[model samples]
Structures are given as C-alpha cells and as structure tokens.
Target: MAPAGLLDAFWGYERALMANDLVALDGFFAPGPQTLRADAGGILVGHDAISAFRRGRGGAPARTIGDVHVRRITDDTAVVIAQTLPSTGGRGQQTQVWCRTTDGSWVIEAAHVSQPAAAIAAAVWRVVGSPLVAGAASGPLVGQTVAVKDLFAVAGFATGAGVPAFLAARAPAGDNATVVAELLAAGASVQGIAQTDEFAYSIAGRNAHYGTPPNGAVPGAIPGGSSSGPASAVALGQASIGLGTDTGGSIRVPASYQGLWGLRTTHGAVSRAGMLPLAPSFDTVGWLTRDAATLELAASVSVDAAAQRSLEPSFVVDPSLVALATPEVQAAFASAVAGLSVTSVDLGDPDELVEAFRVTQAAEAWMSDGAWVDAHPGALGSDIAARFAVAKGITEGQALAGASAFDGARAHLDRVLGDRILLLPSASSAAPSTTAEGAELEAIRGSTLRLTCIAGITGRPALSVPLMTVPVETTAAAPVGLCLVGPRYSDLALIALGAALMAPLVE
Candidate 1:
C-alpha cells in the first residue's frame, strides 16, 4: 500500500490547483531548476517558468479527480496516476513523480498531463468533421486539409459570419465559393468552417456570440482576428491551410501573432464570389500556413496565373512605419533588418493615412451591414457597435474626402515603391493578454492599423513571415512577423522570397 503521507500530499496539491492558490501550488512543486510541468501546448522547465505561466493563466479548467492509482518506486520516491473528469465532458490523465524532501514533505518533481481530444473547439471551429468536404482524387495539393473561414461559402453549410442572428437568417449555399471550389479541385479537403470576428469587421478576434479563440503560440493571449479561427486551427495543426481574407490586417495580424506565414493577395487578383464582404474596396482572399512551402502550394491553385508578376530583389524600409511597433518589436525588427540588403526611406505621416483609411473603411462597412444592424438591434458586440455608431454618422462629404485622401496616398506609394519590396513589422506588438479590454485594446489596435493600412491602401500583396521573436510577460518569447509588401500582382513571387529568407534560419 502507498504511504498515507504521500496520498495526503497529493490531495493537498489537487486542492491548491482547484482553488488557484498560486502560493500553495508553488509550494507543492519541488523548488529548483530541475522541476518540470508539461501539457499539449508545450513544456515549462524550472519552478520560475512554471510559476510565471500559472500567474498568467487565469486558472485551470474546472475538473474533478477520479480513479487514483499509486505505485511506490522507492522509500522516498513514488508515482501517482490519476484520471481527471473535466466539466466539459472528457476523460484526462495526469502523471506525477513525487519525492520526499529531507524535511519529510512530499512534493512533485515532474508532471505531465493529457486531455481527451475535443470533437470541436467552439471558439475556433463552428463545424468540423473527419473530412468535412473531401477533395479530388489527385492533384498537387493532395493530402492537404483546409480550414475555411466562416465568411466563405461551403456547399451544404450556411455561412455563420460569427453572429448567431446573421447565421440564422442565411440559407445553406447551393455551391461552394469560387475560392473554396478551387481549393477542393486542387485536392485539398475542408477540415471545417472556422469562426471569425462578427461580420468580419473587428481585427481583434473576440466574438461576443462565441468565445474568443486561444492563441496557439502564446497560451493566454488573444488570437488576432477576423481571420482568428483559421489561423488558430492552422497554428494548432488541425489544418494545413487556413483559407481566410484580409480586409485590413485580418490575415497579417493573426499570422504575426500565431507564428504562421500569411499572405494578403493583391486586391481583385483572386475571385471573391459567394464570400461575404466587409469592405469590397479592400477585401481580398488570403491564406495562412505553418510554413512558407504549404502557403505557396495553397496560393498556386487559387491565384490567377495571368496576374502573377515578378518583383525586384531590392528591399526598402520605411522608418515611419517601423516606428509604430512596440519597443520590443522594434528591437527585433532592427536585428532582423541588419542582416538584409535594405535601403531606408520615408513614407510620410502614417497617422494621416490611417485616419483616411479608417474613415473610408467605416463608410464601406456601414453600407454593407448597416441595414441589417438597424433591423436587428443589439446584434453586435460593444466594440463593433461603437464603431458602427460612428460610421452611421459619416457624411457623404466626409467619405468623399477620405476617398480622395486615400487615392492620393495610394498613388504616392505606388510611385515610390515601383518595383522594390517594403519591409515593416507585421503588428504593433505580440498578441495582447486575453484579459486586455477597453481603451488599452483600442490603443493597440490603432497603432497596428497604421502599419497595416499601408498595404490596404495600395492594393498590393503583403506577406507576413515569422522571422522574429519578442519577449513577453506571458512566455519566454513570442513571435512577431516581418512583413514584406510587394508590387501589385506579386503574390506568388512574394511567397517564394519569404520561403527563401526563412529557410536558412529554420535550418
């Protein structure tokens, strides 16, 4: 039989975990650099790293212990095997190695946890299957699986658009969207329809109807959205390709936050038939992948070959744009840029351009969804609702003025960036804490939009390459993408260049 004191210590540790008592939980773990804790996300080494993770994680999922089994390895060392019954309906297993210290107190020296695979994560996927929609028998994309953004039309499924009321009002699509059909024809099957920000309006991926998706790279950070679902699915290895859209920074932001390669195709280069529109003027089809190779393959089938163009190898850096990122991101960018062949140039005031883009985007958003929003009151979350309120009041004169300013900015950027690639940070910072809200979230969003609007205004292809890592309070390090903005119709070439740059570093 197992010693009484060891069992008592095990139950005490469980109590501390249930109560989320950080101090008590820390004490339960054998203190030193040799301590370890691991889960599906990754491993945490040393007591300090494990402690830091616990502080940031709001708490463990509520679960009850059952079926405890014990084995004695030695007089002072034992193993505890316990079954966990999660409230969400799943059986999990946890294994721990306990050792008695000189003081005669038992503590965990190492631990590992395994949870039952969920059929679907409600926050990331609206619907899923073993193979939701099968692909063709053979093609270049054979064996690849795709996560179609909820904004896309999949045959036999109604596009949810991340709002329950909107989803309830729609009918099942008779045919797949052009992009979805192209991917399927290329031998890629659909994994499932993933979630998005409501109406694809918000960049921050928190949906009021469905919960926010988890950031695959950073355990307790918000997943960048409106392409939030697909990005998360791809990052977590649930799908090989994340078929999404980038109206503003939807694709690039999430890619940067999740350490994936994302591409925002040139406007009008890929057909958007059957897809919901947030801002048609800027809306463009895109995809996210874990590596540059998969991203290239996915883009090859969908993008128009006739529109493909080659870009000059030369790269340019706009100091004004780089200044918009956080200090940590700025430092990482500087380090990454030092090794590359790049020229410094000024792109003028970013705030002025951001303001112009915001005004026009808001107007377009109102035109696309204002009627529905008015017809169904209280349909949207507070952040998007407030944005629509401002959009509702935009005068015709203001929209025209904003359009004129945006046109001028685009023309100027086109002339300056003729054939050279523009390099900048993909986001203002690494993913923000999930608990971040109110003005703090808005400030981060505003800063990022300034950097992202450059490509949005120019109608050029932009690729977010996971080339830099920045330190964060939540983890040892978080990835920040180095964005590459190429000339119009340079989507394919952009992907190739990114893959080449990433190859050496990954090797």
Candidate 2:
C-alpha cells in the first residue's frame, strides 16, 4: 500500500490540476533533466520543457480523477496511477513517479498522460478570437507576436472583461483599440485575447468566470493582475508582446509577479480610446515584454514620443517605502540598487497615499461599473462584490475630497522628485499564495496596493524591473520587482533605465 503522505500529495495535485493553477502544477514536478512528463502530444525531457508545455497549453480541461492507486517503491519514491474523466468528454490515464525532494516536498520524477486525442486552444489565451489588421504591417514592432487583454477592443471580437455576463451583454468591438491599431500598423500580429480580473478590478489575478492565469516566472505563485493574462503570455514566450491596461497597479504588479518587463505608462501618455474603462480617471494602456529592446520597441510604437523628457539618472531612495517589503525582498531591492549613487528622500505616510488612492479609484470605478452591477445583481464574484459595496458607500462629498487629495499628493510627489527618479518596491512582497483567502488575502492585497498606489495617484510612469528574487515557501527564490517612478511623460526613459539595470539579464 502507498504511504498516507503519498495519498495526500496526490489529492493536492489533483486539486491544483483542476483549478488550472499552473504555478502549483509546476511545483509537483521535480527539477532536473531526469525528470520528465510524456503525453499524447510528445515527451517533455526536462523541467524546462514540461514547464513550457504547461505555460503554452491554455490549460487542461476541468476533470475528475478516481480509482487512484499508489505503490510504495521505497521511503523516498512511490508510483501513482489514476483515471481522469474530463468534463468535456473522454477518459484518460495518468501515471506518476513521485519522489521526495531534499526540502521534503513531493514532486513527480516521471509521468505519462494518455487521453483521447482532440483539439484544444493554447492555455495562455482565454479567447483565441479572429485577428484584426490595420492596413499593411510596417513598423518597429514587425515580426512580433502580440496578445491583448480581453478588456481592450479588438474590432470584430467580443470584449469579455473576464466576465461571461459582460461578454453576453456587450456587442462585438467596432474598432480596434488605439494601441492595437498602432501595434498592427507597426508590423505585430495579434495572437488572442487574454483573461483579466472581473471588470479589471482586482490585482489578485483571479477571475470569476474564466479562471486565473498562471504566473510563468514563479510556478505555484499568483500571477498579479488585473493584467494577469497579458503578463502570463509574455512570461511564457507564448506572445512576444502583451498589451494591457493599468489602472492602479495592474500592469506593474503583474510584471513584478511574472518577472517580465512591465510598464505603467504616464497618464494620458497613450490614448485610452477603444478600450473598456475600469476607472477612466486613472486608466492608461501599457504592455509587457521579455527583454529591454522589445520593451523599447513596443513603447516606441505606443507612447507619444513628443511627451518624453530627458532626465538625469540620479536616484532617490525612500526608506519608508522600501521597508514595506519582506526582509528577503528588501535585501534583493538593496542589492539591485546598490551600484547606483542613491539619495535618501521621504514621501510621507504610504497609508495616507493609499487611502487617497482608494477613495478616488473607488469613486471612478463605481462611476464606470455601478450600472452594470445594478443591472446584473449577483453577476460579480464575492470579493469584487464586496469591493463594489465599499464603493457604493462612499459619499459624494468624500469622493470629491478624495479626488482633491489625490491631486495634491501627485503635486507633492512631482515637487519632491523633480527631474530625479523615485525608487521603491514594485510590490510589497512576492506574489501571494493562491491558497491565501479571506482576511489573509485582503491583507496581502491591501499591503501591495499601498506600495503601488503611489504611481497610480501621481499619473507618473513606473517600470517594474525584475532584477531581484525573494524566497517563498515552496520555491527557493521567486522574482520581485524594483520600481522606478519618473515624472510624467518619462515612460520611455523609465524603460531605458530598467533595461540598463537589468542589462546582465537581457544581454
């Protein structure tokens, strides 16, 4: 008979697989060349190959597993066999050789998946809609593969905003979003529409109807959102460029979580026309890419170059802001910033800044989504529903005052930094565990927003440079981003700075 621990591990693995939690799925596999998984498709010879398949596979269909039988080979190894029935159709067999790693976690050393042959979409895309074209493609982004967030209009395609009801209610987009048109004109091809948080409200990446997109850089970690889908595609190499919208920290947080180069363009830097509004006051279009060159290329095609300003590389460090990170993250941030000459500066209480951001963002979100919520009633996820409830409670007087305060804070930041850049943690910590819920989950979100809200409120450009790693419970080291917030219209400059800081990784 298999050991009790082995049975438990199998049960956990099954749950993760059903949820399409790609990060957790990756953790189940042992690291090294000898570790392998074979399926109807082909043999995956090592950890990297298996991981690539998981990232690009769209996701395994929801399935139920039964008749699990485990055979104990030794103290450190066991064999598990189970039958899987996918919700769509057909049956399959899964065989796994489970081994205990040095850190006492169970991982599959070898496995085989056998299922009835069928066609399936790539796992990274939520909807593989028909592509749109803008005349002949010819520009800086030529030959690049692009994936857009479902919130963006793609002409002929439906915009779901990660909610099924939303898609059902909305008509097909009449025209491509300005960013999409620009990318197409520049020679990039559209791949598909990616999933997003319901109405682009949450940074947790979980969607009520479509499901969460997996974090490609750190398996078993949450892919930060409301831009989850775009970040995942870019990190997985499924798409060369990912066009996403950042309202609050959507683009920067996911970029940090997934270890891709992500930018939150300056407010008004890129036109928001043809995109669904989350909070029109703060919404801005941005993107993610694997390297600095691509990041520059995409930015060139999207951003209004005339708005850019040449700034000195002098850096300002905010200790209070940096202290929000976990010790591991703090150390990583310190190391990444060590080579540059740094000047310490204070921006006052982050809590106050976050609260100001909260009020204004909530007010604007309600303005945009309240009608839909009232019409559909129970259409939203519980967490999002609760957030909407909070927004509903905000008095008009409070909202106006909050908006005024937010503007004041922006002016304050602009004056403090002047032509220099502000350095802070991109996220308070590494991505929160998917299992985290209730108050625990709220706390993680709250803490992260405190750090990210700074750039959001200021409407300044911020880049999440994946130059550091912090230890999470399951993985030895997971990525953390160090943010550089620059003055308005400094979007391209920030990307160039991030590229310089991550030169070793890119080159």
Candidate 3:
C-alpha cells in the first residue's frame, strides 16, 4: 500500500510540471542571460530543449523517475542509483545525488541520470565523501580519520603542493610531524592529504598540477585559498574536520568560500615546529569545520600550551564597511547580527594597518620563495612575481617606516580593542564568478588582506564564521564572513565569542 502522503508527493511534483503547461518549460529554470545550455541530448539551452526533456518524445510523461537505490555520499549529499522511466526505451538507469541546502532541503544538486557517470561519480565522490579511514597513521588519528592539506608532509605520499616538480623533487618524508604524532596518541584518525595550489602561495584554489576541489555548494565558482582541501573535505562531509595554515588568507579564504567556519589564532598561539613556513610572522595553523562549537574542540587540542590564556570573541561590526557588502551577503550578515547585542564600531584609518601588512608579507614571502624565484623567473606566476618584485626594492628606511607605522596601527588597535572585539568582513564581497584573475581578483585580495592585516599587524587572534549566504540561480554563493579578533593570548576568548555569535545566525 502506498503511504498516506504518496499522492500528495506525486501531485506536488506533478503540479509543478503542469504549471508550466502554458508557461514554457524554460520558464521554470532560473533565468540565464542567454548563455547556451546543452542538455544530455545535446541541444542548445532555449525553451526547445527544456520542453523536449519535459515532453518526452510526444507528450508521454515529464522525465521519468524509477526506483534507484539511494546511497549516502557525503554529509551534505546522497547518491541514488535507479532507472529513469524512459519515454522511448524499455528502461534506463540513473543516479540522483541530493545535497542539503541551508533551509534543510535535500535537492537533486547533481543528477547523473546514467550508469557510467554514476559509477565514476560514486567512486570519486566517495574519496571526497565520508567513511574516510586514515591511510597513514601509527595510532590515534589513524582510524579516526582527519584530512590533511597536500602542503603538509606525509611520509610515503608525495607533497605535491599541486606542482609536478614539487612532487618529483620530494623524496617523501621518512616520518610524521610531531603534531601528527600527537594526534595519533589522542586516538584521532588521519584521512589522506587533500589538494592545494601550486607552491601553496595563491589565494585562489586553482592548481595546475592537481585539480582544484570542486565548489561544494556552487557549480561554476572558485573554492578560495591554499588550505582549500580541508574546507572542501569538511563541507562535503568526507572528514569531520580539515587542517590548514594561514599566512595571508590561505585557510580563511577557503573556509569563507565554502561556507565553513575557520579560526586563524594569534601568530604564536599554535606550534609551527613541523609545518611548512610561508611567512614566519604570519604563518599560523588553523582548522576548518561545519560550526563554531566544533571549531572550539580543535582549538583546545591545537593551541600552544602557554598561549591558551583567557579569550572570548567580542562583538564588532563596522556598519560602514558592512554596508558595502553584496546585497545577498549583506542580508546574510544582517541575519547573523539580528537578535544579538553586538557592540558595533567604526575602525577608522585601517590604511596604515593594511600597508604594514603588505610590507611585512611581501618581505617575508620574498625570503620564503626568493631563491626559487631567482632560478625559475619564468616559472613564477605573474601575479606572484609582481608581489615579489615589490619586496625586492624595500629599503631599510622603508622597512623601518613600515615598522613605525605598524606601531601606530597597534596603538590604534590598543585604544579601540580595550577589552572589546570588533566584527569585520572576512572578504569585502561574496564569491566572484568563474573567471580567472582580473578586477574581481584585485578587489578581493585588497579587501581580504586589508581586514586580515589587522590581526597580522597586532599579532592577535581572529576567526571567520560563515553565518550568512546569498542564493544564486542554481546554488548558494559564499558570502561575507563575520570575523572576530582579540589581543594576543586571547585565542580562547575569540572562540567564546564565536560560540556566542552562532545563536543569532540561525535563530
């Protein structure tokens, strides 16, 4: 016997199809500014193709749905293998993978309405999905699974950093880092290393060697940052959490784009004994997770013993800067702020602060990559080369000037942050479109470093939380993240504030 809601379910879906009777089938699809779309049948995206798929050879039935076995693929999505009741054929099989939406809907985010695609999709999806058992582990994190960025050293596995030469040059590490050792002792699991950009330098996650992690929520968008692997791993539900480092915006950028939560604590708050150094002053270990509370768990285990002093995320939002946010992002931010008594303030003259950040980052990055840059001038990407060149001409006078200016920024920071925290944008806007580095890239980098530089300059702790998002035609775009920064040794305080902020976000 069919369930009581059986007819209701069928009718609801059927009514949506019938509603398009007079309205063209294409009308149901989100509007396209006329970019051609090709269906599985290979026709251009207009009303014709959409209607054909719906009409089914001569008005037989809207696309058929048969009983395909449903299998959970990731924390956010599930894949079901079944047959499509075809209009022409006797029977045709398909796989429907449903991903969870913020509003608690599991929609067909990706449908491999065929067998071959489903098989390949299922295998690779699983790698990016759940039930990840650590392939490399002596103990704890071994069976308890954790996803590591390709940037970290793993004994047998090549550290590609998404570069072929890097992979070839690497005589793999003989043993795990002491951090990995600790995780093992704690009975945690170690998932395989995830992907990162070539050289682990770029803010965008495009890697010429290993492919970038697909946007977990968006179809044709970038997955921001160097620590991008762990963000995708957690977002896709493959691993409970992911580990990555932040120098500029490595960890937070990806976390912001993926709508996951991340925290870049005080510079010296975490140990860096074995991690690769990008900029010793700014390079800090951080974790990515689904929520603020889970983030606290990682912080407790990871922060340097002496650095784990009093901490709480003081509410801070610059309404002026917050207003410039994208409409959707603004809505997201506003929704997060509602019902919470956050102390808002304007951080005037963030200019000198941001400049100090540039001077310091470029100088240190030059030290980190300058040697390779000299031998392989042509090998360096133009954007990175441009940044390196800025470092080459920094006179001692300029460095001193930068230091003095940074001191001023610190004074301003001290006056403003007296027992209080300020909320700010993680990035100025939402995720940029699927385009290469351009005006959008320039704007994003400027805004990200500007806000991020505050913590860097003060050597304080900061956390980025994905409290809001804007819906695109087919999926959601990563929105402005609410960040909390506190004075040095206040890593735990920032975590507390993050915990405090969560209620207002979804309430």
**Best TM-score goes to which candidate?**
1
Candidate 3 residue runs with Cα over 4 Å from true position: 1-144, 311-314, 344-346, 393-396, 473-479, 504-507
Against the unseen true structure, what C-alpha lDDT does each candidate score?
A: 0.91, 0.82, 0.62
Candidate 3: RMSD over Cα atoms? 10.2
lDDT of 3: 0.62
Residue-wise C-alpha lDDT for candidate 1, range 391-482, written one tens digit per residue:
89989999999999989999988888888999999999999877676788899999999999989999999999999999775566799999
Instruction: Estimate the TM-score of every prediction.
Output: 0.93, 0.82, 0.72
Superposition error at 242 for model 2 (Å):
1.0
lDDT of 3 by residue, 304-370 (tens): 6575667543466667666655567667777767766687676665555678777766667767767
Q: Considering every candidate listed, which one attains the maximal lDDT?
A: 1
* Residue 253 Cα positional deviation in candidate 3, in Å, after optimal superposition: 1.9
lDDT of 2 by residue, 297-396 (tens): 9889878788788778989998988887778888988888888899998887989898889999999889998888888888999999999989989999
Which one wins by lDDT: 1 or 3? 1
How well does candidate 2 score on lDDT at residue 180? 88
List clash counts for every candidate, in order. 0, 6, 19
Query: Which residue runs of candidate 1 sit more than 4 Å off their true CA positions?
Result: 1-4, 21-35, 45-58, 71-78, 98-109
